[model samples]
Target: MSIIVQEQTGLFHLQSSGMSYIFQIVEGYPVHVYWGNRLKHREPMSDLLIHTPKKAGLDRLPQEYPQYGSGDFRNPAYQAELEDGTRITELKYAGYRIIKGKPSLTGFPAVYVEDEAEADTLELELVDAYSGLQVVLSYSIFSDRNAIVRSARLVNEGDKKLRLRRALSASVDFQGTRDFEITYLTGAWAREGNITRKPLHQGETRFDSKRGMSGHQFNPFAALVTPQTTEYQGDAYGFSLVYSGGFEASAEVDSFGSTRFNIGVNSFDFAWLLTPGESFQTPETVMVYSGQGLGELSRTYHRLYRTRLCRGKYRDQERPILVNNWEATYFNFNADKLVSIAEEGAKLGIELFVLDDGWFGKRDSDNSSLGDWVEDRRKLPGGLADVAGRINRLGLKFGLWVEPEMISPDSELYRKHPDWCLHVPGRRRSEARWQLVLDYTRQEVRDYIYDSLSAIFSSVPVSYVKWDMNRCLTEIGSAELPPERQSETAHRYVLGVYELLERITTAFPDILFESCCSGGGRFDPGMLYYMPQTWTSDNTDAVERLKIQYGTSLVYPASAIGAHVSAVPNHQVGRMTPLEFRGDVAMSGNFGYELDLTKFTEEEKEIVKRQVAAYKEIRGLVQKGDLYRLKSPFEGNESAWMFVSENKEEALVYHFQVMAVPHPPQRYLRLAGLHPELEYEVQSGDSEDKPIIGGDRLMHLGLPLAYEQKDYESGWFRIRAVNPGKA
Candidate 1:
């Protein structure tokens, strides 16, 4: 059993192979006991929870779910306002139940168990005797992964309506600990997921997103590691929120040197009203502990998320190498032009041809035709089905791009229903990218969009859909919601989007869905639940992607990142990189091309053909193998990483240099995730020498890189174990 209860001592311990999370009910208050490397069951576990002096009060003790107005000055996990306008409430431990499997968060995205025996869940019930507000904190310990999935459910048991002012998912108190540094991902627009680390201070340090979606500003992930922690050494704790909307992750050090960590939905401009018998379920937060180091912590997340969080047939399958026409023709391409590009793509071994925006209503550019899903006869004289047929005839699958969440003023849908967008009647309706956010909070609006999209999806032989949301929310007031319930609009809108996705993805299970928000803006686990991959960024520059993809790997699996090769004098940044370097960078993730293939020179076309063929040879290993980041792009001019197969039979190592230096020091790239005793053969494109070496020697001594004289140079090595069984 992964979870153990010491009823006589009022203690509950959730244990995994490498980690343990323990808590105790002390005089009706749940108190955090220990969370770190696993301890023996026979050890003196009760002594771990020391009782503080009465003079110190509740603030001094490590609380499991601290509440405000209870002497705890730190931020509370939840806050509620009563019918009598009072805010103070005390919750006592009521009871708990151990379940066989993890329960899904109603109307939310979470990590799930396919089989009942995969995990054990402990539901700790707490209740406020005065108001009948019941809070159930759920903790699920996975049998295989070193993670604890946590969430909260607030039930309004009383007859009176309970207004929840702030509801966060989970909070943990690191007792007697302050020697920690926080690491998080932060960036904007074209540059998303830049890794940043700083020491934890006395006050609160928070990273959040308030732009409606989990914006490009900061990812809903944070880690606490000692100053001595490195990639492969020391202790680390990771927290990730499984939500797509606004979120907050914070770490605060108290006066006594204890640190409190919390993560969940951002309570900004948010409130939930729970009527009698109604419940509000917060999104789940995944907690990972690694005594070995950050590398192990990240690998645990990668394995769990790749296998459990991401579902459907494509979860374990290789992603197709696609060519999206967005950067190729923009909105200016006609049917013949698109067919020519797809025809070229087919010659280059590209598997999918995606017709981007402007195939819809009067959408010449980003200015119009957002919500209107109908085909634009001007660009495609013969509807989408005809274009799809043309691409299908070229031995390639067909894909379409649609921004179903935005409404353009010039579109027929908006003109017919002006009130369909999220806006205050008297206030100015803010338009971004010349479009307004659709009022997804309204069922009728969602139904209409679903009907419009389903009609087209069913008509065409579409194999994939790039679901893009170009803009964030503004004037967020919903016309369908009352003034008192206006604050609920953002969360409700997220739920509404999830509802629509559930319908579409469930209906067309064969069609691959890739989520995009003007690029990587909405790249989050919540979105990953529905869409297997995300367009990593609009900036397809190889040099820039070195950092973007490197930082994204901190939390997201490489299979979920949609990286592509674009034209030189890159669209986002005017930095010209070698075609080979661009292809090498894009091949690290879900491989694809975003440029017009028909215009490539014969030499360039040949390079692309080789790139496509190389990707096909390694796609399976790259998509499902374990990733080992050898060097960080943010730390130097060079970047390197490796992907090792699960069975330790094959591996791919990628290295990139942004610029060359004269008389540079000789560097060796040490590899990881290989069988230490096995012998392997290493081969690279630039060299014919297939050196056979022991894996232990490769990891300890490493492979040497030959100095190159050019800028934007890159290389990849394919490694295969020799005689695996004999070894």
Candidate 2:
């Protein structure tokens, strides 16, 4: 049984395929005790729960969902103001149940189970009797993985209204104050998702996104680890919020010397006013504990999110290799130019041709015609259908780019209804990229966007859509909503985005959707839940992508990263890298091209052909296989990564040297995820004949790599099992 309840001890032990989470009810209050490697047997909790020098009302005790009114002094996961206007909360376990399958989150995107046999969820109902606020804490254990998903649902069963100031999704309490460190992702627009690690001090270490959108400043992820944790050993706990709005996650050491971690919606400018019978469901939080190190921790997240969190027809399918015309011609292409580029692309084996930004209504530049979905006949003399049909005739699929979340003041739609934009009267509207945000909270606005998309899809033969949001929210006010509900604008806007995505994606299941926000500004689990992949970053330079891709792999999978080889002097970074290195780096993700094929030399054209063929051959393995981070770019001048097939039959390794070093020694890469007893054959571009080696020696002793002493150099290798053995 995945979930076991001990009635006598009031202990609930939830076990996934490889880990366990145990919590027990003490004096009608659920207290968190252990979460780590699975325990083979249950032990007595009398000694575990005993705390000397107790504070008032057990507030010092470690709890699953700590409350304010209780004796615990640390930050409470649940907090609210009662009728008397005092913020105090005290909840006791009221009831519980082991359900057959995982429940879904209403009005938000979350992981789902297709069958009851896939997972089992344990729901514990807790209630604060004085305020009549009921919180249902849920823990879902996967039938075949070592990860557990957690979320909370708050119900206002009281007669009077309650204003919730803080309601986090999950909190974990660790018994020891062992030396620990926190690892998270942080960077700017073009340079995003760089991994940073620092010692976890006694106070609080927090990471959040309050920029209305999940801005490029921080990804919605955090990790707590002991000092001894490494790539393959020690303990590492990862926390990722399946949300894209403003959120907060922190790890704190309280006065009692216990480490507490919490993650949920940002309470900093957040207040939910709940009336009678209204329930609020927090977004899901996925927690994974890896005793084997940070690499295993990442693989766990990658596997879980790839299978359960992401849903669509393309979720498990191999994505096509497309050429985007954004950097090729920017916003100055006509239908004839697009068709000519598509013709050249088809000749080079590209599968799709994407018509980016400028194809829409008078959008020759970023300044005007947003929120106007009509095709600009000036740019595309032939309408969208004619261009799409021409591209189809060239033996390639057609894709269109759209920025449905922003509207320009110069647009026809904005002139018709200026109130449709998110603005408050008497306040100057702020614009980013020369565009203001559409008030998504308004049903009419959402309907208009949806209908516009539907009409386009129905008129054209588009097989893909690059959904973009170029700006963050500012001047946060909605003309349609009253002043009392002004604080709800951020959360409501995200929900409205989800509604539009759900409606359109569901209506066109076959269309491959890719999320973008001026590169990867809005990349998060919430977006991946709707779209299978996201543009990794606007910095397409191969040298820069090494760090970006490496940092992103700490949480996201290869299938969720969109990488492309662009022309050098790269558009964003202006770095001139070799075409081969560019292709090598892009092959680590959903491979594509962002360069002009019409301008390529004959030699460069041949290289593109070979790259297309190579990527198509191994894309299945890279997309679905187990990924291993060989070396981090953050730690050194080189970056290396590998992907191993699930059956341990094949492996692909990528090695990159960011800068050339004087008198550098040969590098040895230790392979992962191979059967130690089996024999494997290895091959590379420089090797004359395939060499066979024992997987045990290859992993323990490592394999030596030979490369040129040049900046921005790369090497690729493939290994196949020669003898079958259990992994």
Candidate 3:
């Protein structure tokens, strides 16, 4: 049996007459490889040979090359690495046999030497193709040393426009219904429940109780189960990303015995229509392997997702915990007011000061102006940068908020360019908040937004952008595109918005970008491509946020949320709570204070002072920590969770009292992490009272319930046990 292996790991590589590597299964899972080496510039064949894994029936595979019977080419330079550690850098068209890399397809274990041969013996057969309406059968193999992962491109070289539905189904000859779990990092971790038992394992299982069947689809994991073809008559199907191919990785995972795997996407999905030789492109990939369990498979999958597929193209940076002022001061604060809040914020360790909506346009409040990206002159005598500079000079970074795709009817942009709105040019245009949506699908729209933002960033010391999308698709239709192209509106709108963001980010790679569509509306991997973090929601109430934040964190890292301590009588839900309760709730996230700080009474201000102090002391521990929910919101009267840093040096626990209970014995709480054999002293965050306790106190004795929660009040107990050595 022969296998193929490629050892080079370049972000992008150029090639002639071949598909690019979108997803490469290295050992047993897939890894991402940027394959667009400046298009049209091909490279000399490197000693790169892609390898196949080793298995029983698939051991002795012959090296095979595709014979071009349909096209006029004697031979194409093929690359492969054999099951042994040797690489095959050249290929000659033989009769019908091609060596199997990893049995990417099922049938053959040997690399084929045939130029062209009968279809029966081969595991995968290219059944049909022409004008982008392509279909085929495939297998997942990883048993050969030197092999060929397939790559196919269907160009729209026909005369009339054609409608097409494309599908590629895998018919792996597995012994039985292969058992595998399909997990997704979607819905956030459950907010309210009894602390869940540690999953039988950590890295393998999803933290949520909500599980679905299908196969883990990537981060937005979903099994491509049975693919269905869509029919298209005109431009609706003009362009498609439908293509598929196959390949395998080294049998044993690098320097380690575990196998690493990657898949190629030059071929496998999408249906496209062609018009008189106009071309449409589709990419594909298929991978197969025999593995012990998902643990190995997941390790391979995660690396590929992060290294290659995460296209935002930025190194991992600590996501900023920003507080937008719109929700805090509304459109009412002046430069001095803004400055005062920021100064207090900085003293409390806030990182960035964001100016939200109503800071632009010819008016005030949420109703008047959106399309106007200019800094509101009435709001501040100086420009936007002046305020940003003020915040920056105050030892904090500055962030600006923009609703680029929205325009209010009362604004200048709509009055001058009514045609740019989404409705029919004649019929009543839909208006919410007396605002119309921008035609982000158009290039002109993108250019205008790009230049305006570029000018702002250039003029100020801006380091972050709170990219917010407030509304969903209300008025669906668009008069701009042709009738057949209307369905492309939503998808294209998203993609176009992404394109504009992509351009902006490329231009200003240093600026951190965040995406929020009314809080999690566009919360998918697609948006994460450009914006690393997102505003978790419009709801900031501590009680309500317990679930929202918990659910959101299950899939996204904790840093993604723009959490803050809003004023009591919660803005969204008018329930007033203590300031301490509010701060403790927001502390678990990218902590920041949002309420107008100066308005508080002297007593309230002191609480604010202590709250800020608490955050400062534990911010690092909270930011870089492992979260374990000690009590699930659903199963208990109260919610309790603990945050432990990567190092066991520090720990903070948040216990929220949801109900009134009778005073009982000593308060006992069984904690998840602590040295089972070590002893240390424990005390409340503010109290100097000493209570030298042992792990047994936390694990066996547990803290008893002694007090009841005030109707709207909450409790936060910070625990720091002295390390025995340090003591």
Candidate 4:
């Protein structure tokens, strides 16, 4: 069993091969004992808990799920108000049960186990006798991964109403803080997922998003690590909220230098009213402990999320090489123009052609016709069926883009039901990209979207759907929600989106869905639960993607990133890059193209053909292999990364140079994650010369990089073990 409980000592220990989380019930409160490298179970393990004099109180002791107004002066995991307006409540340990398998959070996305033996869950119950509020803290430890999934459930067992003001998912109190540093991802629009790191300080350092959607500004993730920690070594603790809506993750250092880390739904402008017998479940937060370092922590998350968190028919399948017409034509293409692009894509080995924006209503630009899902007769005289059929006949799958969550005032749907959008009774309704957010909190609104999208999916042979939301939420109000429940609008709106996604994805099991919120805005674990992959970013500039994709790979798997090659001067950054460099960058993820294939020259067309073929040959390895980042783009002008298969039989290495220098010093790039005893053969891009070397020498001595004269030069290498049995 992964979970072991010492009944006599009231201690519980959750263990994985690489880590352990231990806590004990003292007097009445559950005190955090230790969370770090794994330790053998013993009777004396209970001694690890520090016991202070009664007068010292919990302020000096570590707590598990600490509550406000209790003895603890630090931040609490949750806070609530009673019917009498009292906010103070003390909870005492009740009882706990060991469950065979992890239980799913009601109406929330979380990691799951296919078999009962894959994980063990411990449910620790605490009760506030004064208010009859029961809080159940669940901790599930995976048998094969160095991670723990934590969540809390608040049940109003009393006859009165309970208003929760702050409810966070998980919290941990680390004994010392001065030695720790915080690492998180932050950026804007086209530059999402820029890694930021800083030393831990006296006050709280927070990462949050209050823009309704998980804004592109800050991701819902944070990590506390030793200052000496590097990508390949040192202890690291990572926390990630499995939510796509507004969220908060923070690290607070008390005067005593103890750090309390918490992560969950943003408590800002948030509240939930729980009536008698009603329960509120917080979103799950994944906690990973890596004594081996950040790289192992990331690999654990990559393997777990790719195999367990993401679910669908396409979860384990090799994604199709697609060509989206957004950058190619934007809002200006007709049926003939689309069919021509699809023909060109098919000739160059692209498997799918996506028709993006402007095919519906009278949509010529981003200004109008968003709510109407019907095709415009002027753009496609024969509707979706005709174009899809043409593309299908040319041996390419057909894809369509839709922004189902937005409504343009000029559209017929919005005109018919102006009240359908989220708006206050008297406040002005804000418009972004000339569109308003639909009130998903209303069943009718969700039904309307589902029906509209269902009609298109049923009528056409759509192989994929690029579900996009172009703007962050504003004027957050819902007509269907009562005044007392208005504070719940944002969370309910996210739930409604999930409800609609569940219905559609479950209904059409064969169609592939790619979630996009202006690009990487909504790229989160919650969205990945329904859609296995996400459009990495709207920016197709290869040079800019070095930082974006590199930072993103810190947590997200390559299989879940939708990367595409685009035309030069790139539409987003207007920086011209070599076609080969663009292809190399895009091939590191789910490969695709977002350009007008018909406009390519004969030579460029041949290059694209070879790029497509090369991606096909390595797509399996690239998507499923373990990634080892050799060089970071943030550290220097050059970047290098590689992927090694699970069995260590095959590997692919990619290196990029942003700018060239004259007479640079000789440097050899050392590789990692290979069997030292095995002999391997390495082959550079399209080169006839093959070199055989031992895996030990490849990792220790490294490979020599060929110097190039121009900027934006990139290359890839393929490696295969020559003696598999010997290794």
Candidate 5:
């Protein structure tokens, strides 16, 4: 059993592969005592609780989920309003059980397990005796990974409807720290996932996304670490919300110096109605602890999410090399032009051809024809079937892009059913990208979207879909919901979107789905539960991508990052770089192309073919290997990263120099995760006479590199283990 409960002391200790979490009942409330490295034996700490006589029964003790207006006043983990309009909630422990398998969220996406041998779960029940509100907290511990998934389900057992003002998914209380820091991801669109770390103060520090969709400004992840913690040293704790909706993650330090970490659906402009006999489940929060520092914490998250969170055919499979038409032709292509591009891509060994936006309705520009799903005769006179068939005949799979969450006011659908959009009765409907958001909370609206896309997939032999949402929410109102329930609009919108994706993805399990929202605006774990990958960003410049990709690797795996090589004088940054540098950076992710190949010169075409062939050879290592950040772009002008296979048989290293200086010093990069006893042979793009070095020397002594190139230059190398018996 992963969980052990002491009958005498009312204590429970949950253990994962290398971590342990402990909690106990003090009086009637569950209080968190310890969470860190796993103990070798079951020894209860009698001195875990600190007795405070100054504020008796106040906010001294660390609680699993603190309640407001109940004497113990700090930030609350659960808050609600009764029918009588009171916001007080006094919840006491009711019961608990240790089970074998994990439970699923009712209307939300969560990590799951197939068999009882894979994991064990503990369910703790708490009830507010006055209001008849019951909250069931679940904790699942994987048998082989250092992770625990936590979530809560609220059941209304009273006759009156209960309005949820705040419902956080998970919270953890840590003992007082000497010095603490919080690390989170923050950036704007086209430059997402820049890691920022700061000292944790006495008050509250928060990272929130309230734009209906998980906005580009903040990702739903947070980490707590001591000031001495580094990438490969000290202790670190990571917390990630498995949700793509608006969310809030906060770290609060109390007067006594202890810290509380919380994450869930953003309570700002958010509410849920729980009538009698109804229940609402929050999304899961995955927590991982690493005694070996931030790098191991990231590797744990990467391994668990890559195998358990993401699903379907493309989850563990190598993604096909695709060529997108957005950067190439935009909205200026016809059927013949698309076919011509597909032919050129096929000759260069690209496996899939994606026809980005403008193939549906009259979408000649971003201003019009969004919700109309019909094929436009002006652009593709032969319709989708004809175009897909032509692409298929070229020995390439067909992919189409659609922004289904937004509707143009000028489109036919909006003209017929204007109430289908999210608008108040009198206020003007705010628009982004010249379009209004659809009121997905309406079942009718969800049905319309699902049926429309289903029909298209059935008509055309489409093997892939680039599901996109172009803008964030504006004018937060729902026409179908009541005035009191207006605050439920944004959260319910996300639930509806997840439902639609679940239905479509489950129905077409073989098709590859990639999520996009104005270029990574909604990149979170929840989307990866449905789609295998997400477009990293709109910026394809190699130097910029180095920072973006490095920051993203703190939580996400390389397989989930959609990267592509674009035309020179890059569309986003307008800086020309070497083709090799672009290819090296792009190969660090799910490799593909976003440029026009037909216009490439003979030499450039040869380079493209070489890059495609090279990526194919090491794609498995790049996608599924353990990532080690040798040199951070944020810390220096040079960025160096390495990927080593789990078996330690193969490795790939990427090194980049952002700027060149006269008479530069020689640099040596020490590799990671290699077996010290094994010998390996290194190779670099058909270069011969490479030395055979021992893994210990490579890791401890380091590999030397020449840094004499100009600005924005990069290089890659591959190493294969030499079997002792053969040598």
Candidate 6:
């Protein structure tokens, strides 16, 4: 534990169980009936109060309630009820210490605040890990009800330098119910309208909520489906409003399971490597409510998710199992090679064939050919339409990949109009993964992307698009705009992308889009507002994937995680895990494969057949069921994960040993969110038990954790077919 409070400022502290990071609220500015259980201070800490504009006088600030109609607290705050109950007061006291801030030794200083109108907006300046490394994040805050207001920017005054080797994050907490249900998801990096293809409106960049959700993603970010609640129990619910983003994320609820949150993160954007000077950030929020289902949360978020379309009509829920060719083919191609794989894929019940990153242009690899959206006839003699036809004939939906915002220097588009890239025309530009970022803030560029994609979808029975944004913005200078408008590009770029997605999804309701940034570089709530699912990771090995997927599931639903079985000697980690084990592990979420099945041996094919069979059996349970995280995957001992039936009729449990030992005795494990009085028959299958399972038996008897020597590697876990709600 560490507590380092600035003199006369709010108390500062941080601690962890070593497995997960934990934070406690100490003394701070008192709000309307400021409500947090006082934590025991183990060490001597000074009690100090620091207020801004001190001479303004702290009196008349209202102790029993908030200064109604006073001002905005967009930085983030916890709320205490109002005096008359007409409204609630939320306050975000200033903190002197920064978790990760500006002039960072390596990157830039960063902070996020809701625009006065309350849309997630960020302000920062970062160093480029890659050359031409300059970044600008600025936006005017006003308009939307959920927007951020004028935020105090963290700056690099030249004298200060900071470096963050690992992911540096800033979290904004919401003041909500201790007893409430919260929902979160990550996807969407697109939208519709001209939003900002011109004189960067730093002031008008917020959505007009009165318009009933216009120009945002498929869903909006941080929604409160139900009204706030002020109840929590045990040692839980401290930060009733807190959110973080890194390689992965998670949340903790009390034993009731009553305070449920079906947090769904767009599975793609699995991981990112930000070296010394790069900066990364996410728009995180806390949705507070007391009781209800996931639908309620969706309803609230959708209400605020500014868009020109209606999600109610497009509620075509359920993400399809996708087979991405990138992991299999790796840019080297031939239509024949893909067709062969699609044939096997159809047989295994794969629903979509996503041709990732290389089906177009002179793009033989990731190095070149990004901006040229035209089909590269050299790779596929017959063209994209022909490839789509072949895949459709194989009884599967065809999906194409496009990094629409990037242009390769070697490509036709880039060569023809070099000035089209994000640069000052005379100045140099930055490049990552062998491609330059297209200026999305430009109207013509955005139009080209929208038109090209709509044309492509029109040419074939394309059901999905794997929209990829491989890197963050850098060396920010756009020659197409005036100097004053140049800094507005970053914010405008986002709005432009959202504008494109809104139009596409509205036009093609049947077509689904998956957002990906590198392997999992840009996993944020902003993205989830558009796409329903995302590629969880580039790492497909089962053993290593368990942790990656586990951490992902903390705030995201299983349905959003795009997991697949690929050839062993996992490309990323190089661990040669068994094919069955890989398939079985992936079965826990959106199931698919990343390897070339056509090249697989006969035995491997048979294993896939069985794997498909297993997936079909557990699909419903995994998609809609209640999830539980048993042991720490980060910890070497026994690790466990399970999915309980949506209706509580069945339960599927899967356990793996990170580090196994011989002669281990039967260990007892306590199941979470289970009822004791309900007698449950533990006869294999994911189910809801009807009979009295008994609290004593459940709590006292405990679950059998120690498996037989052979059962350990064999991956032993019971699939209890339950009859919940019965006698």
Cα lDDT tens digits, model 2, 234-272, are 999998898888899988887656888999888878777
Per-residue lDDT of 1-727 in model 1, one digit per residue for the tens?
9888888888898988777899999889899988889876744476776687878878887888788987888999999888888888788899999999898877888899999888999999999988889999999999778899999999999989889998999999998865999999999999998999999988899988888999899989999999998888888999999999999989999987899999988998888888889899999999999887888888888888888898887988899999999888888999999999999999999999998888888888888877888889988889999989988999999998898999999889888999999999899988888999999999999999889989998899999999999888989889899878999999999999999999889999999999999899999999989998999899899999999999999888899999999998998889999999999999999999999998999999999999999999998888888999999999998899999998898899999889998888889999998998899999987478899999998899998887589899999999999969665
lDDT assessment of candidate 6 = 0.49
TM-score of 2: 0.98
Candidate-wise lDDT, in order: 0.90, 0.88, 0.47, 0.92, 0.88, 0.49
Off by over 4 Å in 6: 1-284, 288-316, 683-702, 705-723
Candidate 1, position 648, lDDT: 92
Candidate 3 segments exceeding 4 Å error: 1-127, 130-323, 346-349, 424-427, 474-483, 647-649, 663-668, 673-683, 687-709, 712-727
* lDDT of predicted model 2: 0.88
- How many clashes in each structure? 0, 2, 126, 0, 0, 74
Sorted on TM-score, highest at the top, how do the candidates line up? Answer: 4, 1, 5, 2, 6, 3
- The C-alpha RMSD in Å for every predicted model, in order, reads 1.1, 1.5, 14.5, 0.9, 1.6, 15.4
For model 4, residues 1-727, the per-residue Cα lDDT tens digits are 9999988888899998878999989888888888999989988675576676778877877888888886788888999999999998888899999999899877888999999899999999999999999999999999889999999999999999999998999999988544799988999999998999999888898889999998899988888889889888999999988999999888889998999999989999999999999999999999999887788888988999999999989999999999999989988889999999999998999999999999999999899998999999998999999999999999999999999999999999999999999999889999989999999999999999999999999999999999999998888889998888999999999999999999999999999999999999999999999999999899889988988999998889999999999999898879999999999999999999999999999999999999999999999998999999899999999999999999998999999999998898887888999999998899999998889988999999999999688899999999999999787
Instruction: After the best TM-score superposition of candidate 5, give how far the Cα of residue 234 lies from its true spot, in angstroms.
Output: 1.4
Mark the regions of model 1 whose C-alpha exceeds 4 Å error after superposition: none
Better of 5 and 6 by lDDT: 5
lDDT of 3 by residue, 654-689 (tens): 777655666534555667555556565555657687
Q: What's the alpha carbon RMSD for model 1?
A: 1.1
Reference-based TM-score, model 3: 0.62
